[model samples]
Target: MDSTLPSPNPALLVPPSMPLYDSIRGSIFAPSPTVLITTILVIFLTPIFLHFIVFHSRSPISLPTFLLVGPAASGKTSLMTSFESEPGQPPVETRTSQTPHSLECFVPASIARTSEYRSAHDPSLKAHKRFLLLDTPGHGKLRHIALTRISSTTIRGVIFVLDSSLTDVRVVAEYLYDVLLTLQSSATSTTTQSKKLLVACNKSDAFTALPPSKIQKLLEDEITKMRVSRSKGILDVEDDGEGNDEKEWLGEGGEGPFTFQSMEEVGVEIEFKGGSVENGEWRNCLSPWIGSCL
Candidate 1:
């Protein structure tokens, strides 16, 4: 036998690779019916798909807002400053806020996103990490601003900050009573979206500071007294008063002390959280609570 076989046929050799551009053009312009149909479909439908996926809603979603309201010196401003700063940074001292101010902040993994909440299957939809934190002045005169903002459709939550060591619980409880009442007034309809309340008992590090549970109990008792006092001050309206009583009450119409649970019946859910703003302990409790809301 010959040492080497006859030379392999040239036809068995591989051809040189075609340019990418030429390959694409040939694929698109091929005479096969399926290729033509696919090409036409891509040309006509790609833009439509892209238009919906990319440019459907250009304006940003109205971010979910959380309003911080409390009596002055209760650490509302300090807490806001703490929230604005990164963790482990020495606590920043905040001046008493003179006017209502809003800070757009990102709470990673705790934001209430419109995309995922409103339209889940959308490619543009996602649970964003953005929310608006509105810190209102806590002075008695400035509280009207907070009350008005509470009714806003944009606000999803409220934080009522109170000094846990305050000598006078009545005043703080009075302020909280007003807030809970405001939340309850609109909580009537089951169809309406209810707002959440977080009673932040700040300064829990102080020796005199009461625990969150004690603070909640004191507030409930004080509100019970107020409801009775106000119920006695009823005044009559003369102009065809449509067979209505002139008194407004908080929680249910029972005789016992008003509990935060009563508010849930009307849709306003209340949570009591104790934290030391001086040490930035609030972030731990708040992160989980906000995540639950989302």
Candidate 2:
């Protein structure tokens, strides 16, 4: 036999490397139709499934309710606009100008969007609660409907707004005091927990903008004075044999102690910003007094 045995058959010899075209042909020609179809289906269905999960996860059991009360031109509309424009959502404007007597405007959230809106905001903030911003006509007429909506069990909070630059602060102050008195009386009668209140004290942007510290101080002083005035009224009621010092504090007539606790203790945040409408310097001013209700 030849030393190499006629060299191992040439056909049996393996090539050192495969050609690029061969690799390309192998990959392109053997297409896996089943795998391709499965991948396509997954891509199409993933987003729909995820969206369903998110929607159901955030759905609310019940919506929260909030009340908005203030003097005319108190920026009730503007404040609502701001809240509507809060983060992670589009601005939703829902206003009903013609409310019943004693109530100027009633803005309710759209029932269709109630769930989506509430779910986006932080739950701890209780943003999902249905908010009924009731813009009362004025102090003169507030008494009529004061008990109707103000005292409702569903009401979670009250926003009392006023104009900062008004010549006579007394008139606005008196109106708020009356409203508070009514609320206090109602709370006493009902076993349901009283709703929290927030005073906006809006339009700090008028004249020179008041620093938050200064605004806080003014609010504290005003609340203290209101409390003193209320305490005096409480003292006037002659003590009854029942020994219930609070029992004398009946009806909406007597002024209960005013507190800075709402401003001091609750989620009563302040913003010294300009009005949305031009030429309207003191559009809205919510009282810091409402904070006590929270």
Candidate 3:
């Protein structure tokens, strides 16, 4: 019973810590097989895994495009400007656009996204509905851009804006007829996706502006005439031995009025909604309609 118990065995004392250099040298030169294999695997596979993730995130998705087409001075640019701007701000006046322009837009959660009524200030709604709004030149000469997009782009919808207050509806109707004809002709093609057309009767705030229903009827009458006139022209071409494609007709093969309903056969749906962008009246109807298409 010595007080210190014979100073405990010397071997029982803790060993000194390994030197830093020795530890480093041993780890480097004498790593176990599992550690060596793991290091090799990580070094070889890290770049591959990173590349896959980066490429996957960067891969392009076929974005749904909504085409805005109409005759010149139809407020297409104004509407485009308004939709892209912050809410409640007046739309910036834009001159007749001679080229195609596109804007990124989001449908609010109140619409096709969540069905829950999200306030206009809801920040989270911005992430849910995203699409591209492609504004094509409304000029007669520049319409080829719109047609090209229709053929090449994965279109979700078309907004054909026209002034409903104008007394002479033929010009608007004629342009619409051309656009509809193009869509109808391409509907059967394998490359084109089926799309809906929304005929927006702009300037509905004017006293003379026609209601959407009336505008629809007027367009129907004019399109019927256009069908007849074009058929005669095609016949004339045939008479000259330079026949054209019969598929260019706007509606069903008959003498009946060329109603928008007839476009369903060719996979085009037609809808008419009247609103005045000048008064900020269209966003409620138009935004939801666009979201549904996406």
Candidate 4:
């Protein structure tokens, strides 16, 4: 055989293209309406598809929490219902909650102090400005639910709803006293950030409802009495190395009466406001206070 077998026939070396292959090639290169439409759709829609994928992930977003706490029948759940209900609709009926319940709420730009003054329809306010309103059980046995939330959650603010129509307001004051003490101790030990407390006097529509001012006065007097009793008890206990005596006090340590103003020293800013959810009044009134928390 010749050393190179007659240069393997040149025609055999060339790739023989079948008609099917050529037809397929022609269809691809010659853009049809369908191909053009598909290409254009991909080019235009890819970005939006990616945005949906990246922004709308399965993970949950964390929002600042505002705790609602008070004695039983103080309308904490009713307040929660008012916030969760739609505007212009009747407020939802609420039962006494045994566990913590959280609802999402957004403060509109028109009244939100955290947001710049702008049109209420601003789109940015819909997403960035939101918070959770956490309602806790008010019964004595269940109140630990609220206290645990205070210690564990990133509590942005606290709403202490008190029934102004209560015949014996001392119970309300005692509960509030314990809550304030808890907040005060946390404020002292924690960083310097000031905590906001809104003393919402609910059921102001009642005939015998007390005004915010009167409620504040009564609470001050009751807290003063509480401080005295607690101080005496502290003295009765064995004196450990810890400063239990000073820690037990609510406001400025002295013989003077305890006032809400005195709580400022412990980084607690207290505000008293009266409103009745039944009258559809407090929602708007609370906007400014909630805004301040943001």
lDDT of 1 by residue, 1-294 (tens): 679878988866745454676787787677679877888999999999999988876776798788999999998877877767788675677888879888776655423433336444554334346677799998888899998888787887899998998678888888888888788775663367666999999999999999988888888888888877765443233234544342266777635777888888778999999999778887666766665555
User: Model 1 Cα displacement at 145 (Å)?
Assistant: 0.1
Q: Is candidate 2 or candidate 3 better by lDDT?
A: 3
Index of the highest-TM-score prediction: 4
lDDT against true structure, model 4: 0.82
Per-residue accuracy of model 2 over 86-112 as CA lDDT, tens digit each: 333433454534353222222222222
- Model 4: ten consecutive residues of lowest lDDT: 238-247
Q: What clash pairs does model 1 have?
A: none
> Roughly what TM-score does model 1 have, to 2 decimal places?
0.71
Question: Of models 2 and 3, which has the larger TM-score?
Answer: 3
TM-score per model over all chains: 0.71, 0.45, 0.74, 0.75
Model 3: CA > 4 A from native:
1-53, 56-58, 113-127, 191-193
**How far is each candidate from the true structure, as Cα RMSD in Å?**
12.7, 14.5, 8.6, 6.8
lDDT of 2 at 225: 67
List model 3 lDDT by residue over 82-194, tens digit each. Answer: 78666677777789888888888777555664556767777766565777888889888888888777755578888998988857788888888888878877776655557
Clashing pairs in 3: none
Each candidate's number of clashing pairs is 0, 20, 0, 0
Q: Clashing residue pairs in candidate 4, if any?
A: none
Q: How well does candidate 2 match the true structure in TM-score terms?
A: 0.45
- Candidate 3, overall lDDT? 0.81
lDDT preference between candidates 3 and 4, better one:
4
Descending-lDDT candidate ranking: 4, 3, 1, 2
Q: Candidate 2: deviation at residue 211, Å?
A: 4.3
